[model samples]
Target: MMEPTAAVPADGSTARRIAPSRGPETARIARGTGKQWRLFNAALSHTPDFAYVFDLDGRFLYVNRALLELWRKPFAEAVGRDFFELGYPPELAARLQRQIAEVVATRGQVRDQTPFTDPDGTTRHYEYIFVPVLAEDGTVEAVAGSTRDITDRLRGEEELRTAAAALSRSNLELERFAAVASHDLQEPLRMVAGFLTLLEERCAGQLGADARSYIGRAMTGTTRMQALIANLLAYARLGEVGEAVAVDLGETFAAAIDNLTSRIAETRGTVTADALPTVRGDATRLLQLLQNLIGNALKFRAAMRPPVVHVSAERDGTGWVLAVRDNGIGIAPAHQERIFGAFQRAFTSGTYDGSGLGLAICKKIAESNGGWIRVASQEGTGTVFTVHLPALE
Candidate 1:
């Protein structure tokens, strides 16, 4: 044992006690042992996961601090104890013994998931691995393993499965309802519009100016209603196209322009289109999508500028991106998202006359045809509508 001491002045005028000296062997041994134990504690006892070693006979050899704390058993009581004596369920103890035996026989590793209950009665899931520890003679000495808690991971997977099932059912019901309602409403609307036309033709001469004006307003209302119903039906039938075929988008663009020829002439709009790509989708629906987007550019023209729309296509990883750039009054940032929703219009109907279903229908059609749509706009500058579609090989 070393004794405590007080130092004297270097002049040797005061009394002093000499300090005891331990030999170099003692100092070296202390330094080596300190470093070894510190590393061992960090790698095993202080680790987050549960680590343990047991013989092929199922006797516990060592358990790390994490496992000891979980079991609420001290090393003195846990060491050398059989798996069952350590409070593991008999079935679990036997299953673990089998896995350890297999690892020893194969001289390899085995991994598995096991459910465990802590001393506090909280059940947890563990993903564990067993590795064989071999003796000097290559015989099975023990099995070493670690287990990570995975209860949260299993719970998340179960929740995702449940949500996916619910969403699938909701989509099916919505499709059925939209199809039936649209089909049923078409006939009655047609009859109302036909009778209104007949009344205007038959009673025009006999009616006063006010009555004639009222009839004209009624005709306009019916016309707008008919357009709404048509858009609704088209939206419902979007993804219902049976199978996609190779479609030349150049032809599709031409067809869309032809459908809107009168409107283009009325607005004095000029459409310049680049060479378009051939894509895989229903040509009729693709034509409709283009028609709506081009018509929108024409209708929403700036008051001072003649609408100049440019149509172009380019390849975008595994798909084609077609852009319809318009020199029109661009959409406001605040109203951009709402305009794509059914019956949602950004501008007042008085300023921009529409049923507000054009963009919504375009979105649905794009999605149904294995594509999607997006708009980039600035309030007073201009707007560009981009559509992404899968290209034909």
Candidate 2:
């Protein structure tokens, strides 16, 4: 942290340690001296944040070392240069000039935040403070500005915004799903309840074992449907939308596969991958996406063979393409697209006990990141689900 410095007078009348004037002693001794001013400048320059003093004409009167280091430019290059002449974008420079003019006209400070592409071509967000300096006639003379780099803060705010949006959408989707589940169950539940009553009415004289078994199956199906709906809600809200970043997909996949290590070991499944490219994506969503695809490969397997899953990725023009192929019972071509939708399953419920929201969630995450999921399969051969994510650039 940079130590705070007290301000100095324009005539440098606060400190004499750097350069003491031999012309007079009490001239500097009248209620303190230029030593303080020199100390203030010396202190402010060492601060972490960028600080500079610019005249009303937008010429940099002084800049701290931090400012020069941040731009990766020479101190001599930044000092004594007009703000317009700096490597900053033309529009941003113009906006800064306008802001300085605003402070000069109003004789007050102005604060603003903006993101800019730096000289090295990386986008950075900065928060600025512009303080107006008044002249002897009470007119604005210069502006003292302090800038704080806020790249992390902006990214967190964006992640929060994304979560709020996804939460809103998920809430609406859950409501619709709840309504559908209720609507589908109401009649079946009523029919079961009615038949149980009918069996009770007739059992005193003549209910058979067949009737009892039929009633039991009916009750069981309804109970499973209720559980499925509850599970669906949990599945929909599994992963919260998170900060999007340029993540190395290879590392992400490794972490995800590690999470499934126990299952992979139990099934003796061999998992392999190609180099996955980096992408601007939500980390949590990507994890969930991998979990679902890899989990399915493990969950559904052939009776005679241990599961073997191959994961591979490559650049596909403007996007990255990844595939999870497994030696499991595959879907028929006609049912491939339907498998990705909510509550639409080609497999029997007993064979795979799932709410069937995994692929649906994957689809949403992919589309949200400007991508999509696709499939290729044959019934006894195998299945390959491919995910495509657009490159950040």
Candidate 3:
């Protein structure tokens, strides 16, 4: 056995052991890799969204499955056709051409929605992207774009809009009815108050002081209710009745002072304003806005002090922000948020006579003009009301 093992040294320089073979598996792997690439490319072409490739010079190189369906033309006819030169619907073609020109001019990505007419003559909406493609050398090689058909979404939106419009119309009719009804209710209440007042006058001394007080209370309640109704109607007609215009805060302050001239004289109140920026709003509302705030400032001054009202305006990023500050008995922190709400009043009717709606109306006016109002105050220090409105352009 030993002699057999050593007989020929097994040709040590040339002989080698057999290693495991990988031929079949390697061949299978190569086939699988090819299959994956082919499948990937196929899926890309057949994708549902409209995807396209264009050359650097703005020529169509490829279109995906959905685009073919949209164009309703065979790939053979569409392939290599000048995408921009090929006439789509006139409107669609014009828009697409404009957007393409813009993208090419800027060399930046562009996105927008456009409407296209399908072969069936139905309009379809698409949100599309036009993005630059880069080459291996880091240069822009071409543009690749994808478009999503948002026709159904647009249709649903339109339907919902129509429904909302109808509902709004109905609600407006109701609001009008309520306004009419408020006037109607006021007529009857006025008649009752007139009779009560006449009776009180006629029977003054014969009636006890308690009876007179009761009648006075009744009159006050009726007046407050009437005021509340009027305020509600005013709020309802805020934008509908008020015209949009440039309001000069300085001029508005003068008018507001005139309206409350008696109160200003009584309280010795002073209102000073800068050359406030002209803003977009209803002039009458602006006047009323100043009147309410200036009046409040005068009415709520710290005890035994002359009132001072300061109104100024400055340009913010998107608009003019106006501030009406006052040295008055400032509002409490807990009441800051509530004061702007409709029909909210901190002081009693004895201290202040109002429907508790002035600030709320001010807010409404600000919002209707695409802006808003805010407040900052501490009890007994001062109060400031800031109103923001779209500035006059």
Candidate 4:
């Protein structure tokens, strides 16, 4: 064993003794080949991280000031000791010894984390790495280790997880309430609609023009209310749908056009499409997404021309971008982002007959499938809605 030598402080402060282990090989390195020991001690002594060196036998050969402060011990007590002799718990000490042995045996690095309670009774999480210290001949002479306190980082991660769980529960409860309320309200709305129709038929000759007009307005209000409620329920229950799978975009596009065949014929609109790609998502939701976009294109057509809606697809990296372009009364830039929010519309119900949940539903469906939707338009020219979806893996 070499005698403990005083460390040269970089800041001209009081010196501390660093002991070298009992062995010709390790003692020679620890004695400092010229000024190497002094430089090493000075660089690591004041660092916040705990730095130390261990011999092949897992005995402490050197420990920096930070480590000594953590243990709340002097050089005399900790320098010549292993983890077990320093009063570390049996399990922790054994694990650390094994890591140190592995580093020496493999001549490589070992990384791990553990929780430790300091002498001051404050428990902290630590991430540490052990690496072999090789001699000039490429032989493993010792194992050098560094440790950092990661308690704050771990605490932050746990807090984020707790907040996310709380938010998820709240959303689930809200969705359930909306679905139940929507279902209950439908029967009453149907009854009101039915009664209005009967009143209009039976009292057609007796009622005056003003009285009939009031009844017509009432019926329209009830119809709009029913549509709003249905859309709200669909929005809330988006998460309750089945899991996603590979779906053929071509089939979904064809189905949407077929469903809108009557409306297409009534407006003399033209719907065309190029070959679409397969995507990873719920087929039902994808169909709904297409229907909503295409429906909006048809509903918001320019007064001077028949609706011209074209659907196309192109590759976007590992994903696919599906575009629905229409020659309709385009949206203003200010309303582009707002249109994706529930109950938001660029135009009033009188101008466009819609529940205002179509684009919002499209946005939700795209996001739920690890994709997104965006819009570009110049009011009075036309509008383009592009939906990015993941390619089937």
Candidate 5:
């Protein structure tokens, strides 16, 4: 019985059997994998970032074209050579070697910012990382590294810092001027109002009707001016005094209502509030913020109905959002943004008696206490003023 005999080994040992070749589809997949590796290698060579590999002893194992061009050396000269021997500054070379050693020791990656000098002798900033490459036995065999030029980014950041410093100084000067001017101007305004009152009383019978009317208008103008100065001073002084503390908004609401007791009674305004959260801010400023909003609601009532204002607070992200919604002559869309500026009035003084600094003051107070204020309203509908403030722990 003939059985196909196995071939004898040339070295007198058993011969190993061969497996059949893979199908054409398998070959195609293998070709695709090789193509991907070639594409990756091409990308590494062409990318702007410098890519390289270093052995355990900090000897260059593989250096991409980008790194070679930065060094102004050929790849043959770079491989097997240490970074310090390739024209890099000693300090920088030492720092990078230390980082590589740390990566090898911890078998982890290290990332940092480094400065390097160009061929033109100008220092450039770079953000780079050193990643450990491990062998199959789980030991770190090499360190792969990449560096991105961050010189432009660093320059931009420096410019921003400089601009911020200048802006801060300008704000401080403006605040000081407002405080000093407001204080000095009050005395002269008081004298004018007092003397005008005396003149009107002394010459009451002798003065004609037109003269009396003129004097009355002068009195009104002085009163309005005084109010404007007071509000400007208040706005400038926000966050200039008093440390922030845990303040119960419920108490603030009560105090605001108390401040507007006379107006509320005159207008028969009904102001209701929901349970409010305690926030971190100056109690005095918070009370003022509430008073301004409530006062506006009472003053700008929809003539068709008695003023109804609703105050409520809710949790919003890392802060508390308090809203004062009022049934009043709402603000037009065009004037909503401008109303927040100091002395920027959308309505005439004859219609609404205000210094136009209330919302501006509220904005400053909110920002100083780490918060912000915004308004949402439509003409003839209603107005909602929202203040977001950080809640107490």
Candidate 6:
């Protein structure tokens, strides 16, 4: 048998290799091993991801074609060099060396992300993982690594963050404007209503029926305007409310019913409920939501019969679906979706006494609590408002 010898490259550089033996059997085995090595190299060389193997000393033992291209160095130059010798930044090289050492010491994987500038001056992000290669004895032999370019993914995420920040600022500005405008208008509206009432009282005997009617209409207009302004302020302040907490829907429902007790009696309306669930939400907002829905049911009753509103909850996966069903003048299909928008009303103010912010506020509360509210109705029958809220964990 002949001893294995080092193969010399074209540059006269000594390389680790096995010298050809005299026997044909040894030569056949060497050829088969070389063919397998070629096949393995070819497969790795074609992949877009950078693949490499590092010796225990943090020196590169092998680098795939993608890595060679990234480094802009030939195989001979990169294969024997470490990160520092290959011109990686000192800090980055040190970090990589430490991670490689960790993988070797723990016999586990280490993953990280980093930014690198190419020779062409284009900086890109990369995510890489280093894993230990184990020998038959369960000892760390070497560290193998793969790096993927994540620049596009990171760029997309940054863009989305920028858009979200812009939207948040815009919403804040709009809410502030609404609050200021509604607050400033209220005092003047009150003054106008007060003066109109005084003028009607003073001129009662002298004025004709038409004059009194005009004054009465003017007072009514101002009253409705005041209500609208108040509702606007409330809606604007929704964004300024405190964070959500665990709230018992049953308690909020009871409170809402208690608040509307007088109106319920006046309208001859009956409000009933089933067992309610505990939800993750603000108690005040949840109470307001119930008040709005139940109040609407009472207010929009058909003249032919007294109102009947039923509140119930059922399990929906890990959450609960709260339903407020009412036998009243149901909304038209065309107007159901529109009514959720700010100041949108399905019926005229003359027929329905409301500022039209009730459903809109309910919708906002639902969304802020990571839930949603929807309505189902036929024109003449009744309406069902369903709110889906997550259960408190």
Best by TM-score: 6
Which parts of model 3 are misplaced by more than 4 Å? 1-49, 53-60, 65-124, 127-147, 156-160, 239-241, 348-350
Q: Candidate 3 on 68-125: residue-level lDDT in tens?
A: 7777776556655565566675666666666666666677898999777777888878
Q: What is the C-alpha RMSD of each candidate to the true structure, in Å?
A: 10.5, 16.9, 13.4, 4.7, 9.1, 4.2
> Taking the tens digit of each residue's C-alpha lDDT, what string does model 5 give over 1-393?
112112111122211222332677755654554455455556677789988778898887666777778777765677777868877788888888898999999999999998888787778899999999999999998899999999999999999999988877787887899988998998899999999999999989899999999999999989999999998878876736467899999999998998899999999999999999999988888888889989988988888988999999999988999999998989989999988898887798497888989888888888878999999998887899999999897
lDDT minimum window of 10 residues, candidate 5: 1-10
lDDT of each prediction vs. the true structure? 0.81, 0.77, 0.76, 0.88, 0.83, 0.86
Q: Rank the candidates by lDDT, best first.
A: 4, 6, 5, 1, 2, 3
Across residues 1-393, which tens digit of lDDT does each residue of candidate 2 receive?
112232232233442233334445644553344454566677776788888887777777667767777677765566556767886678888899899888888888899999877667788889998998877998777888999989998899999999989989887787677667766866677687677767767784675788777777777776667667665754555444567788788888899899999999998888888777788888778887887899888888787888989888878889888899999988878888798888778786477767777788788888877789998998887899999997878
- TM-scores of all candidate predictions against the true structure: 0.64, 0.45, 0.70, 0.83, 0.79, 0.86
TM-score of candidate 2 versus the correct structure, residues matched by position: 0.45
Tell me the spans in candidate 1 whose CA falls farther than 4 Å from its real position: 1-37, 43-48, 53-62, 76-111, 117-122, 129-145, 180-187, 229-291, 302-306, 312-322, 332-338, 349-352, 361-374, 378-381, 386-393
CA shift of 300, model 3, Å: 2.4
Better of 1 and 5 by lDDT: 5
Tens-place lDDT digits, model 1, residues 42-121? 56777789877776776666677787788887666776777778878999998887888889889899999989988788
- On TM-score, the stronger of 1 and 3 is 3
Per-prediction count of colliding residue pairs? 0, 11, 0, 0, 0, 0
lDDT tens digits, residue span 1-393, model 6: 334332212132323464757789877776666565566677777899998888898888777878778778777787767889999999999999999999999998999999999888889999999999999999998899999999999999999999989988887997889878987898899889888888988878999999998998998889889998889888987885556789998898889999999999999999999989898888888899999999999999899999999999999987899999999989998898799999899998488777889899999989888899999998668999999998898
Shift in Å, residue 309, candidate 3:
1.1
Q: TM-score order of candidates, best first?
A: 6, 4, 5, 3, 1, 2
Pairs clashing in candidate 3?
A: none
